[model samples]
Target: MDINIRRAVIHNVSENNQDQLRDTIVDAMQKGEEKYLPGLGVLFEVIWQNADEQEKGMMLDTLENGLKQT
Candidate 1:
C-alpha cells in the first residue's frame, strides 16, 4: 500500500480551529503512543515550513534545550 503521511495529516487537520488543533496535539502527546509520532512530525513540518526565521530559531533553541535535559 502507498500512503503519503504528510498529505494525509494535512488533509485531516486543514479545517481545524485553534482549540481543536491544540486538543489534538495535547491528546497525542499525553497518549505517548509511537503511532502518534508521525502525525506530530507532519505537524512540525508544516510549522517549520511556515515559520519565520526568528520562529525557527526559537524552535531550534527550544529543541536544543530539550535535548540538553535528556
Candidate 2:
C-alpha cells in the first residue's frame, strides 16, 4: 500500500478556516499522539514554503530556541 502522507494531510486540512486550523493544531498538540506528527510536519512544510526570508528566520530562531529548551 502506498500512502502519500503529505498529500493526505494537506487534503484533510485544506478547507479549514483560521480558527478551525488553530483548533486542529491545538487539539493535536493536546493529544500528543505520534500519529499527529506527520500532519504537523505537513503543516510546517506549507508554512515554510510560503514564508519570506524574515519570517523563515524568525521561525528558525523560534525552532532553535525550542530545541534548546527541550
Model 1: ten consecutive residues of lowest lDDT: 1-10
lDDT of 2 by residue, 1-70 (tens): 9999999999998999999999999999999999999999999999999999999999999999999999
Off by over 4 Å in 2: none
* Pairs that collide, model 2: none
- The C-alpha TM-scores of every prediction are 0.94, 0.93
The candidate that wins on TM-score is: 1
| Candidate 1 off by > 4 Å | none
- By summed lDDT, the worst window of 10 consecutive residues in model 2 runs over 5-14
Please list the C-alpha lDDT of all candidates, in the order they appear. 0.98, 0.96
Any idea what lDDT model 2 has?
Answer: 0.96
Q: What is the C-alpha local distance difference test score of candidate 1? A: 0.98
